[model samples]
Target: MRMGGLTVWFWALASASALLLGPVVSSSSTTWVADGTVLELDDSNFESAISSLDLVLVDFHAPWCGHCKRLAPQLDAAAPMLAALKNPIVIAKVNADKYSSLRDKYGVDGFPTLKLFIHGVPQDYKGPRNADLLVRYLKKFAAPDVTVLDSDSAVADFVEAAGTFFPIYIGFGLEESVVSKLALKYKRKAWFSVVKDVSEDVMMLYDFDKVPALVSLHPSYNEQHVFYGPFEEEFLEDFIKQSLLPLAMPINYDTLKSLDDDERKLVLTIVEDEDDEKSKNLIKILKSAASANRDLIFGYVGLKQWEDFADTFGANKKTKLPKMVVWDRTEEYFRVNGSETIGEEDQASQVSQFLEGYKEGRTIKERVGGSLSLTSFISSFLGLGTVYVLVFVVATIILVRKATEEEPLRVGRGDEVDRATSSISEAESREAGEKED
Candidate 1:
């Protein structure tokens, strides 16, 4: 039998056996620890307990909140390390909804509010996230180290320490974004933090979520202010007082409009559904392409405003729902139907090809290789598995047959028949001798 056939037979038998008893043998379980046993803090124990405990960390949580759910596992894993610390702190959790009095006492407004208390009182606190800063704060004032904290703790303290000259970065949306790019370019020094989801206390403190939000953390608040919005390099260059600053400023829409006809390129896309998965994917690809090349201008016109964009581009929407129109500075634009008709598995491949062709100013040859497509690969794998089982069965049958047909050896002594034959020969010899006499 062939090697492939024997292998296939063994594999098929093993798989069928595994499938028969899989559910009966496998199991998964989760242990839920009693909250009150592990967590030791209550309204009655709060005052006396806080003073005695060296470090007190309280998590004010709710049943709902997706972010809270994601954070819980991390916090739980850290509990043991916290417990092992010298003059260790007690970690406690509180459901704000269940314990309204405690919530009121702490002024808890957020879904998850982590508070660190020193000597039965809430010390100047910051967290729920930002674990590093929290750890540092706890180690400095709350722990036995007696180490002094950073100069910028409170809002007033930050303003006081930041003196006259400071660094500033301006950008829209996520504050944690690359505002520092322009700041580092000019070599302007400043403090920076992006605002995503802020608390009520924080909102009241900042006053407004200002666009072109100028964020500066320096002693010279008056000298540096960052405006977060779409901006031109010329404006940025003119605005900078010092020539020492390096800039990573992005090109604005106006700059692209001023470019020569040959150098300019614009991609206009009509997204019928903003929330659709296909639309999201197209947007992601476009954004990446736009970031990589400055000459490639990318813009999205929502299908929500399809008529306005279609009329302007003279786009044919009868056949295509998600259409793309590309143009130079001329009135006429090259157009294509909705990104290979939506449900394409290789949307990224298609988009990559589209953009590369557009950038070269002429249609490019296909770079995508058909090196054993997915379907063929899967079919080949299954065929090999089948061959292995057949080989295994043939090997097993041969082994069994060889075992059954094997000849057994036997041991024997000289028997009666041999003795009789010898006696008869002697008798015949004696008779022959008498007859001759």
Candidate 2:
């Protein structure tokens, strides 16, 4: 133990500490592996609990992971608060060592993997592990309490007031009607208000024609979108859920920046002509995809308005039209659909594949377009042209020098040419004299 220069006592103390703070499992009733408000889960009950509870947060952990031991108490403290919400949630913990298949099924690659199971669908939890944050995050799934505003002026003031929640639904009818029921159903996602026997002016102010009408007002845009209805529960529920999101929100400077800041992938549909059939279809296609992907942010940019913004992402009307892309901030990657044209089925499939690939570190990134791309292309062309031009000029100068230089024999040199001419004249004179003789 003391063979090295330093001591080895830290190991013994750490071992003892782990043993002291470790999970306790007993034959009779000593302690469940997960203590306090958390429920101890096994393979048998894991699926049943998730399917039974409308909202259940599952913690996949092992006894040896240091983070799990630390998170145990935090989750235990947050459990009661979660259960106290309108749509209560159960906090369950599974010992991954005992239930290997369950852990693998849920893709628990790391220690203390937290997954929020909503109606039996599992989604990875990315929020902080602290008790307060866990409590608040889980409580958002529960139906929010409805608040009633007094007087017409009060309604106006309240509607005009600034808040984080958007499209605050104000019901102008009785509390016991279908509106309250709808409010209760969707309260977790949206804010709700009830005005007891409100006036016609109030309804008209919010763009509602009759009593029991539902008015959704957006304070940021200072405009109201009205929904007068059959008021059936199904219709109202569907309307609230879908109406909460604008089908294809235009991606502008603020929205593009926001997309970069967001944790999830931003699926932007760049459509040039908003009135074109292709553009119109994108709204529905994107809406369906958004419905399937509630975790990811969905947006669209018009080719006319936000063309510059789209250009940054390498999408323009001429080359890549009506396409879909997922910008992964974490990986710094971009994946476009394989098909050139955007089809509803193809977009959904490609997006699904991108999401799946992203988890496994398989997303491939390409260059984002700007002046840089054009500069690179021009540089490449000029670089090749410079090489060829240099070769041509060098070859021409070499040929010209070879043709104009003095010859070695009596050909082009000044003295050699004069001597050759004189020798020819003398030979000709001697031949003429001999003929005369």
Candidate 3:
């Protein structure tokens, strides 16, 4: 079978089996707001609390936004649990309608934007809004990035019991942490565990001799790959990429060179960071996309690492990661717009549409910046308004000062004229008296 066909088949099977699980996980809760848990905030406490708190989850919402209204109660219920995390996170809400300053500052374009302030830097929360999920996600910020499998039972249950359905990334023996960073990086994609202090009996169960070894076990895909350290972050990433993509392959230097010059169009995702939610989720979404469309070759390229490759199509300059594009192997690439650079959860429909257009021999072009046009227009308008206001104010101030100074000068001139007139009248009277004598 063709590479694209193989990719499509593999992902479809994984998703159908629930190995690639649906993203959303939800729960129930009561109507509540900052009851010793959540904080009711305006401009006043927003900055101070976010800056002061070790970790905080701030909801930027407009009153009229339906999503914001729906999310309110669940957020309120999740507040206490989130606050009760190890580092004790603070949950705060801002009415974006009342405080446009905060919303605009944070780049909150949507109605309900969840910004998680970790040490004062705001990060968008990409997980589910369900109270339980929110609490779990918030709790991760407080907990250790990697959880060590302490017991033989813990290792068995977490690793062996994960079966082939879930991707279990195991960091075996001598875990001062060679791959801990990688484990954390792939947290959204895989279950990661480190065992630095494993008993000899438990260690023998896996039958690996290396002091620091990393293994990926996936039962659903029936795959097992092990790598012995010195494990760097890059090595760990490459390892996982090779393992998960049994049918669908990762886009890299060697892979890019290997693309057949046939009629197959390459769907490449420009990813900057593996740790980012957008990049990771986009990869997952593409896996499903590959499953559906067996004819199209779908893969991702890391924009940060592969500057030369990104420069080929000017993708390197794009500040955003997880941007999709379609290449026809004709020295040009057409960007695919599924929903604004990995923000949408359901990208399968849009991706499929792009593929259908290609199949029908339609000329699919790159997405030009409507965003750029709109921003430039708004900026130009604001710039003009500021200049007009400043000019008007300056002119008014100059006019007022000129009038005040002129009034004092006019009064002095009038006094001089009166004195001269009195002297002239005295001189004429003296001459007349001399003539009469």
Highest TM-score scorer: 3
Q: Candidate 1: where is the Cα deviation over 4 Å?
A: 1-264, 336-343, 363-437
Taking the tens digit of each residue's C-alpha lDDT, what string does model 1 give over 269-307?
A: 655654578776777766665545545566665545434
Ranking 1 against 3 by lDDT, winner = 3
Quote the RMSD, in angstroms, for model 3: 25.3
CA lDDT of 183 in candidate 1?
48
TM-scores, each model vs. reference: 0.26, 0.40, 0.46
- Candidate that beats the other on TM-score, 1 or 2, i.e. the better one: 2
Over 1-437, each residue of candidate 3 has an lDDT whose tens digit, in order, gives 12233232222222212010111111232222223356777776666565456566888876655567789999888877765444566678898756867765776544577888876788667556888767755554655556677777788876543434236777777473666666566544466778766677755666566567777676554555677854666756766655544334466533544343235677777777544776666667777777566566777767666554555554556555456667765435675444335546466665566666556655447532322232222222222222223344443455456643321110011222232223223333444555568
Residue 123 Cα positional deviation in candidate 2, in Å, after optimal superposition? 6.0
Say which prediction, candidate 2 or candidate 3, comes out ahead on lDDT. Answer: 2
Off by over 4 Å in 3: 1-36, 156-168, 180-192, 197-211, 217-225, 232-234, 240-437
**lDDT measured at residue 368 in model 1 versus the true structure, 0 to 100:** 13
Task: Quote the RMSD, in angstroms, for model 1.
Answer: 29.5
For residue 404, what is the lDDT in candidate 3? 35
What is the clash tally of candidate 3? Answer: 5
Clashing residue pairs for model 2 = none
Q: Which pairs of residues collide in model 3? A: 8-290, 8-291, 34-38, 164-219, 164-220
Alpha-carbon deviation at 52 in model 1, angstroms? 66
Q: Give the TM-score of candidate 3.
A: 0.46
